[model samples]
Target: MRITRRKRLLIGLVAGFFLVFVTGLRAFDPGFVTSIRLLGFDGYQRLWPRTEADYPVRIVDIDEKSLAKFGQWPWRRDRLGELTTALAGMGAASIAYDVIFAEPDRLSPHRYLPELTREGATGTELPDALAKSLPDTDEVFARAIAGAPVVLGYAVLSGDGGSTPALKAGTAFAGSDPTDALPAFASTLTSLPVLEAAAAGNGAVSLSARDTEGIVRRVPMLFTDGTRVYPSLAMEALRVAQGASGFIVRTSDASGEIGVGPPKVTDIKVGDFPFPTTERGEFWVYFNADRADRYVSAADVLDPQKRAAIAPLIEGRIILVGTSSVGLYDIRATPLGELVPGVSIHAQALEQILSGDFLSRPDWADGAEIIATFLLGLAVIGLVLAFGAIWAAAIGGILAAILYGGAIHFFRNQGLLLDPIYPTAVNLFVVYAAATALLYFLTEREKRFVRAAFGQYLAPEMVKRLEASPDGLKLGGEMRDMTILFMDVRGFTPISEQLTPTDLVAFLNALLSPLSEEIQQREGTIDKYIGDSIMAFWNAPMDVADHARLACRTALDMVRTVDRLNEADAFRFRARGLATQTVRIGVGLNTGEACVGNMGSDRRFNYSVIGDAVNVAARIESSCKAVGADCVVSEDTARAAADFAFLEAGAIPLKGKTTPIKLFALVGDADHAATEAFKTLADAHARLVDAIDANDVARALAGLASCRALAPAALHDFYDRFAERIDAMAVAAPA
Candidate 1:
């Protein structure tokens, strides 16, 4: 049993739909992608299209290369002293290190030790000498620290050890806790004198990005260590950068049974002005890790040579000195790269937060993504049903590309966060696969029905169209502003006479399928087949805006499609010992008022057209062989075309016509080469027209010949008809 093309396409479409539905239902992750998009926002803030509406503090990266040049970890105190002094001299606004000088420097343990390690070593001369060298370094570093404004980092332990109640008075609470609150993420300590004496401001650098899947996002703004709430690394930088008097954490009402805290905003008062934030302790980081920006390694500061190039960024900048080396375990996994600099990530976040251009996924985003995907899928499927796989895919791909690219572009340039990947991919995959599959099944079913009913006597496209517009198969008629197209296969009669009936049938089927398909695909109704001639009409059952353009496109495709068929039939033609000349078709199309619908009795109805427009189209097709033209149309048709390019083919009076109709030859101009060639012909034709208007028959003939020569066989057929008209005018000219 042969299956019809319609059924095949329908089956394919259904399968494709199922695939899309499953993937859309199961694979989408709005929260995850949203978080990644936020990170991308940070990148945009720091990188391309920089903004001044961002955090002022700059990152001083200790990159992998710097690590290789300088020795391993923990540089001596004297080196740190030099760095502090350099920053102080440059008049930097403030210098805050993300790293803590938690333990006494190994080089000067006894000198700066918090009395714990110095008790037994005081009597030893070896310890004394080491202490003497190291303690002096500390005093010099301490003086540098003491001279310039500096905010040293320390973490508050949330669960156990943190700033005591005594230290809690001046610090701001991150608002009242919602139910039981969690502890500060990290904690740190230093000797009492070290913490008090050298510090201009004491704050915690302990903060963390919560991860649903161990991917850091949403950095905490304020971390609580039981009684007191402390600032984050970025928060400390802001305070130092702005010289703000203090920080304030604001919270909104809680929701639900758990009473989760509403989004918090951190407000900092700079002088008399307030700087607000999205989260309690956290703001976006603006990353500006330019190669030329301020950067220095702890090892480089230790070395005299490399430190010069790296020292300038530290000058008054809230310099964040942290490890960027892969070996040092300071590298972080960010949306951009796995080996991203940890400090740079913070810097980028800070920059983004301060700009108020955070990568945001509001609660309403998930539904939007799903809706977009669903609609896009539906669109792709509908187009496939209307067109075919190749064209549908092309259109689908273009749409997807535009959407994704536009989203990324908007995010980077306009500071908007939107997900382009999931919607585009999901839509393309689901819609295309589902639609194509259904179409394949429909087409298969159509092929089966056609093979069973027509027994390979009718073309595939005709069968497909029959199935598509079965309503038109009823015995009736309807008036429409239609463009009727007629195609006549050149040399088909002679070729058919030469071949056996079986071979001729095969050849005819091969040539007719694509031609008919082109017409149907362009939304033209296949009126009927008259031996080697095909009659089709556009804007019949369907209203087509550019009916003339569709007619032209259909005609051109029919001519081109024969070549594709000839390639496949080349072997058969060769085996028959024939010349294997390619089968070519001549087409004539006209747009005008026409009567179109099913004709004949109910038992055997035929969908067809009948009107002057239809007659003119048929006459044009008949004239193709005589004029040596492949395709031609009346001026009425050309005027209706908004796009197709054409060459003038002089006026010709039909047998029963009172007024001679002006005609034009259809020329291919879809690509640059064809368009250029056609342009040259058009220019020459214009000159010819000018000569004819002036009754300069000689010049007109000359211009016509030039056009003919320039385009060769391409316009030869059209030129011959013009030449005849020019000759007649020359003979009848007044002497």
Candidate 2:
């Protein structure tokens, strides 16, 4: 199907927003960010359970308890010899120490490198005098080391030049090229300098994640030799644990990329665009720390007695020994926290890569980000321009915040880092700023429209809504239950005719200002105005529940307002000059269905009320002046206005009607008690209807007089009008 202009605009806006959101992903690192937070301190503990394995490579930790029982760190080498011998005796597969032995023990004959041929040693000098004078501890330690699978610790560093030790034939990593089929980029990998001689291959633990500002965010996976990549600490641990010969690296020919892969699914989440990755495989982390099966600390197994504690914990485990103590200063800052262990961070990355649960940002992510920003900008501008500045601002802020938070969550939880920061921030700034500028122009234009449409007649608020939802400005009507009010300033035409044009305009401005403010304040919509009159209604545009009460209350408030105006000292109008003399206003209220909204020709449209309810309200207002009552309301309005006290005026013939309409006067605040008393008396008068029906006119007439006495002056004045009409009707009745 063909799409409309608005629909096409929506589609384009959405497409643009997605593009912007995805492009933002390139600004962040996935594995580095996710690994740190996911494997927090608590997560780190899971990799290291405090228990021994029965069969396999295991880690034994030198806990604080073991340290207290044994000697301090760097114990006599003979003790280490004994521990190694015991592990060899237990048939351990292999023993790897995370500790470094860069320096010789002081107890050795040379105090650094003792000669193997030395037969015996007592103090610093091994006896050259005797053939087998009992070798020093160094010889004993060397003997133990030769008897077991002892893998020593070594670290790699980057430098301009370094001496290359002769390669041990069996010690190098044996593997296929892991990156053979990968796409190439600028060399971001750093080199490692390796020189060591122990039992097995060495590995690196270098984390290289960056922060929001693109600083290093996490540990690197593997240390390189400025040419080739080597296994990391965690990878080495996995190798030791699995007893694997080496990592398997598979490669396929470029044109020989024969197999069709599964279709990829992209998640365009709610927030900012994510960091782009080359493919699905780049984001992940390995988990390793504190596992009884994986790590061993040197401080534990040195003591022969404490060695039992470790053997039970590390006999068949793959243990990683990294710093948890704050003072070790091995912690690195991450999005997760500043105290995350540098070593464990690498472990998490390894785990993710191995599990193949990487956060994928396709090369298309950049386009996604650009699109997301554009779309969000359009939405923000549209809302702001279509509504007002306040609503537009609210929507823009909410959308921006949601998108930003969503991108971060997707990264951390799903291994997908959609970079939302830049796009969301840019969207908010650009959209709001642009929308504000546009709105300012629209507002200025609207003022002109207001002047053209209603400056000659209608209220300012009406003009604002007309511009706000211009669709509602059509000449149509909706039937709505509304409270209609009619207000007239008594005898204003003669006064206006006598005054100059300037004085008339000034007077009208002054009088209408407070009166219009009063109506609007009560949420009453002004329908229209006759000469010196205000016709308004409630429950339109937005419906109010107690609109009838609101209408009546506004009428009462207007009555009080006139008195205050008459008392004011700023007397300029003809009526304002009169001393303490109140100007009279007649108000009528009715509640019923009326056609409301713009109700006129296209050239001269107006938001107004039409139909019988409006006519009755006007009739009631006119009846107020004719019957000498300040305010009159239909019984329907009176019933709905529970807040105001109402007193009944007997039914009277209204002009252009044979049916006598039931009416009530609106009593002001002081008359509440009197009005309530009148209700009671009126109830009694109604009961007298039964008396009159029984031909007991005496009691009926008596109750009527009682009702008159109890009512307030306004109600009584209405009752006197009723009495004159009743008397005339009775006299006019034929015998």
Candidate 3:
């Protein structure tokens, strides 16, 4: 097939569309694409997790053992005050709580005394002045918080709420407004006013999943509640430890970042350390395997005997007060597949910033990926237009391999994130789509030749197969095992005499249409129509499974079709003002090896079979009238199609064969063959053949009688013919 300029241009248009669609998807960056891209970055972390190193971060866990040592949660505020005082005494650098003190302590003396004074019948009231003198537990906890560098946590909400988080640090930005890029919340949930005011820093404890399935992959460095900005728990802890007064943030409009198209937060500085952040002022934390050394049981911290051992771990470390108890519901998932306390995420974020080992996805990554995809995908489409899809796809595979290798190298060595999936997919899809369009055009151009050759002879589906792959079929022949069929109308000469020329054509078309349908429906190829007969065969052009059985089934179906046509008044005998006549058909089947293919010359040919088996089938169809059977098959077909109800017709002299060939009468299908009546008829017919071979006149007559008694009503004529043959044999056997 030669390429045309118009077709080549069409292919180009198709390939270009594919490239655009894929590149546009990357630009749109839907949730699914984000998920796959994030998954690639996650694979890097899983391959080489962050190394476990000593950092100034620790979790003072209120685990199940701590609960057992003290009591269940919501313990009196006085105990929390004691824990705070103890940490301060140990010289802890910073204490960040992953818990909310939203409500006042219920165990305070003033709290219960006022309730008792209202319920006088309970008789547990104290004097108003004495109750006022008693200390408030929340106040005690607040005083302890004031003594140490404590950062209290608050929750972020997306729904309607009235409360707002306390702002502990003032944010100063250089270029664009930092609040424009940071995540904004509708409202916030803050802790108790006294505790929040007394703490050195107040920060958000909440962590957003982004697209990591509830896994903490990104931590917000700053948040906004529409008007005010707030720092995260980790950021506040870092600031308090360093004794920094405020934060410095920079954006795209800054001096060094001015050429960018849009404003995006570029850098943040807490005291002496300068750090980079995502456009939304978020920090990407590289995670390591959870370290057991990073935790100290709160119960152990309060115990006098254990305090000495834990003091060294707590002295310079930023202690996060949180619970690891399953009942606390403070657990969070990570890329490493471990569920750790929520406080650990905040602690890790600080560790990442302090250590200065980071992973960053630059703003230019998407543009780079799109440009690579368009250039590479265009190369493949050009190759498809010039050479074809095969060469183009081969080169595309090489390009994809190179792209993946570079992406993986960047991730491992440079700690940079790049997506290789979108570009590779674009190349593959454009090449495949262009190739399919080319095939369809080529097939359409050559289909006329195929349709003229086998369109009339073979079924529509078979013609389609040839059209798809013209190479598979050629002007040649191959010997294959096939089942041949020959069907003819009974008493055609007599019927022709009754109808006019036009009526004869009409009658034949009406009769042959249904009979031909029966053959084609069973996957048999109709070779041609000879007068009132149909010649067909199976297992040609394509391999038909169980071709022999299918032939037998077609034979039975044609017989039934003719009977139906006769019952439907299709003969048209009465319309001619003559006595009504019935229609009958005879079908012959034989299975054997034969040469089946295009048998004629190159320019003009027909897909037909030619061999001794085909002749045998024609001869067997002629013998149907002599045997008084509607359907007859040779011994070869009977052996292959034993599941059908076939009774032996004994050895008879077929015209061309040297010896007599055995024949069978096909009566019914597999279900009828399984019946006891068919079994009885088969047994009696076998005995009759044996007696005829033995020349036992008495036994032969008796067997013939038994066969007639067991056979169907329509088969009485067949048994009568068998009886006549037996009588002729007895006479020739003269004693």
1 or 2, which is superior by lDDT? 1
Best by lDDT: 3
User: In model 2, which regions exceed 4 Å deviation?
Assistant: 1-58, 106-109, 112-146, 161-195, 209-221, 240-243, 251-283, 286-312, 319-460, 463-735
Q: What's the count of clashing pairs in each model shown?
A: 65, 81, 0
Instruction: List the candidate 3 regions with Cα displacement exceeding 4 Å.
Output: 1-9, 113-123, 383-394, 426-735
**Cα TM-score per model:** 0.49, 0.46, 0.60
What's model 1's lDDT at 169?
A: 15
User: What lDDT does candidate 2 reach at residue 262?
Assistant: 34
User: Model 3, residue 627: displacement in angstroms?
Assistant: 54
Tens digit of lDDT per residue, candidate 2, span 56-83? 3444445444455565565566776776
Off by over 4 Å in 1: 1-72, 77-82, 109-148, 154-198, 201-220, 225-228, 250-289, 296-315, 324-326, 333-340, 347-367, 381-414, 452-735
Full ranking by TM-score: 3, 1, 2
Relative to the true structure, candidate 1 reaches a TM of 0.49
**CA lDDT, every model vs. true structure:** 0.61, 0.55, 0.84
Expressed as tens digits, the lDDT of each residue in 619-683 for candidate 3 is 99989988789999999999999899998887878888899889999999999999998898889
